[model samples]
Target: MESSLVLEKYAEKNRFYREITEKILSGKTLNFEEALRLYQEGDFYFLGTLANVVKENLHQKRYYYTINRHINYTNVCTTNCKFCGYHKKPGEKGGYTYQVEEIIETLKSTPELKEVHIVGGVNPELPYEYYVELIRKVRENFPSLRIRAFTCVEIDWLSKISKKPVEEVLTELKQAGLNSLPGGGAEVFSERLHKELYPKKIGYQRWLEIAKTAHRLGIPTNATLLFGHLETDEEIINHLLTLREAQEETKGFYCFIPLAFIPEGNELSYLPGPSALKILKTIAISRIILSNFPHIKAYWVFLGVKLAQIALLWGADHFHGTVIEEKISQSMRKDTVVHLSKEEIERLIQEIGGEPVEI
Candidate 1:
């Protein structure tokens, strides 16, 4: 089979991507080449149309969102990742750690917020107990508020510092008021990409281990993948497969968030960000690939209001809600909005022909 002929035969047989589109529509997974071609060929307009069929089939016009606040406990990290612009230097003026009392005070200040997402750079001065104490105090302050804090990297850090297994650290954290783990720091699971792009970050296995442990401990978790950096098509699929396999094992992932790499003052300033079309394709692929997980979330923070509104047609069942304070974006994101108001989210969904969910 000649190379061009093989590719041509696929296009001819599919004939307007009917076969591939149906494969996705029928709830089947698309491989590396198929997923990449969706991005490479400039055909997302049609792809988004097809993906909406799945979205409507699975989720009609209903959209899911939450009232959440993202708090950065500390910005000091041991791993000075290359693509990070938010981490302060060791002697940097703004580098400071929040005590449990300070964090409780911050939580007390916000009355409407029910969920708190606490994650930041890996801190050296604060040991695992600091996190435990923080979670306990936050819970003590607001017993009803759900704490969606910590990342896989932080889990691995706790494992090392406390000299305990990952499961033990997670158990301790959970007992102290940790509700669940947020899906961050999952840039790309490709080892080659990981070594090249973020050498200071945790390894792929460590991340999987932490999520798996959290699931075993009966903690619900959210997973994410960062595209548009230095990952190949096969690498992207591999990242998805890693996530899918973990979900299959634990059945704990609540949402699959496909976050775009917003290149601003980011360390990877030279890298081009994913286009609107690519972002849509990624959302569609996430919906098609992550069959184990029930929800596919479209994070409006990095994608901005316009693209996120359009993404509803691309199998995005959940429109991520207003993040009261999002430093993660300003750290490396280009499209940084403090908080997309409820009114803004509602209008966007209405524009997309989807209804905003009250929850």
Candidate 2:
């Protein structure tokens, strides 16, 4: 259907939605207040339709996925964020760290792997050489593979451990064949939430500094937001806008991923996680706000396969990847699968009338 006809059909009854729809159709960027209003008051279906329009304008129904493997190198973390269930305190039982060779062997076992995602806890025990060696060996063995490793949080920890500036640390890692940084640990950009939820982790300014540094050095990274916790609507929109401002400067963020908060085994388990409607609304709002971003991911690991599929039409273009193993979410929800086959991924995208583009 034409954009005007679609808008007329779904949004014409409400002037607020109709005006917003017209503004989106005309290619005008939404201000922070406009985005917050759309997220707070616009009809859910109207939001989805308008977000899909913006998505189609950019990607034209191409849904991206990757044949990637996630390797959580260690679970012994010192930064004990209340929302996390994956970390073990230092020297705690069940805390495990992978040797460089073990990671290589795991890669050897998987066939047709295009990318290797490596992330883990802030282990003070491991020397800085461990990280460099891990990256160097992975690059040596899988010369063609893409290595997306470490979050800004982990990078900050590495800087402290190595006694090197973040720039030097990222330079050494990039030289050792780190392809990009994953978007984790950037739960929310609000200082209130930072102090309340994850006081040990790096604050938003430092996180953006590290990310912008990576961008300046020619390394692309993804951005993420962890919602459904103790964040208000204004805080969420501000987070997206802050990222948008950063992207305007660096253009380094390759994708924006809205991660649904999973409140299962964490300290905040008493609070129920975000509902499906909340998830879809956030994803759509993320697409509308982060115009500088090229892709929005409905990370299937947290959203579950079905909702992630629905998210494709609601403004998400990335179905994440065939994550061979993801220990973080699995630690919280026992039923979370460690892997999804390529056939299954393709079928899910096809069922939603999306063409899967393997990255």
Candidate 3:
């Protein structure tokens, strides 16, 4: 694809192809759709160059890494959203909630880990006090560890259950040592497509509102798009815009994670998997459009190692976690070993010529 094709395709978009080609040759920001088009049409040379330039520019060939552990505080979710593989039904054998002692025991043992990523089901029965006390106790016990916990969905559910304003709950959590919010459950942010995938769950706009509220209240949060699962190009653009608008308003979104939908033992079983090209295009486009956020992550667990490595050049700056016990999404795909050890994670980041930086 020539420079003109991208410019013509994204005429009104602030960062068009002509500007992108000029920037590429002169070394500036990338053109979003041109990169998307490259992913669509397989422009290897262009994609490779983009990755190398962006990666080197970001870190100068140095990859930073951190050791972290994943602890599912609980798994009993009432909003058993179809796309999720983690939620446990009432009578299901695996339905269990973590006692305060269990989570404390797990945290105390892992002294080497610097971060704790906590996310689980939207179980209304799990009292709001469980979360508040958990954060307070964890912070009091391990003052050094950064607690990157909770999804926007969890915050929404918790607030509604507690009958308190969103800001007040977040304020209490922050005081108790809540660090950041994860970008999970953003499964494709289109009104039409979201209804098909997660009709029973909270609205997509509610997710954005909570995320925005978190950022404004001094909490940094990551956002994601679960693409390649019955969504169209128009849907993708719309999703990006919603996130972009939030970024513009709060300037607190830390990264944009383009998640590849896993289709094993799930509702969308017959859907074909997304190709590497499609994945890379989405990543590049995310980086280009969500220009306000600093990092565009290429998550290894969801996309697999090979694609994540290749995506380093396509405007992706971060390769998300060094999860010791990542099991939720892994349950969806029988063959995937969801938990990636720190060393294994470093190997992949180093292989791609990108440094994994610690928070």
The most accurate candidate by lDDT is: 2
Global lDDT scores for all candidate models: 0.78, 0.92, 0.75
lDDT of 2 at 130: 99
lDDT per residue, candidate 1, 270-308, as tens digits?
888888877888887777677667788888888887788
> After superposing candidate 1, which stretches have Cα over 4 Å from the reference?
1-16, 37-42, 333-335
Indicate the residue-level lDDT of 191 in model 1.
83
> What's the count of clashing pairs in each model shown?
0, 0, 7
lDDT tens digits, residue span 1-359, model 3: 54235434443444543455456545543344644454455344444454444544555665544577777877788776666777787667877888877888988787587888888878866889999998888898889888988898888888988999998999999999999998887777777876777876777888888888898889999998988878887678778877877887899998788998887767777878688878887787676566666788878778887788777766787776677677676677766655666777777877765566665
lDDT of 1 at 237: 75
lDDT of 1 at 69: 77
Instruction: Please write out the lDDT profile of model 2 over residues 325-355, one tens digit for every residue.
Output: 9999999999987788988999999998889
* RMSD each, Å: 5.0, 1.1, 4.5
Sequence-dependent TM-score of model 2: 0.98
Of the pair 2 and 3, which is ahead by TM-score? 2
- Which stretches of candidate 2 lie above 4 Å from their native place? 1-4
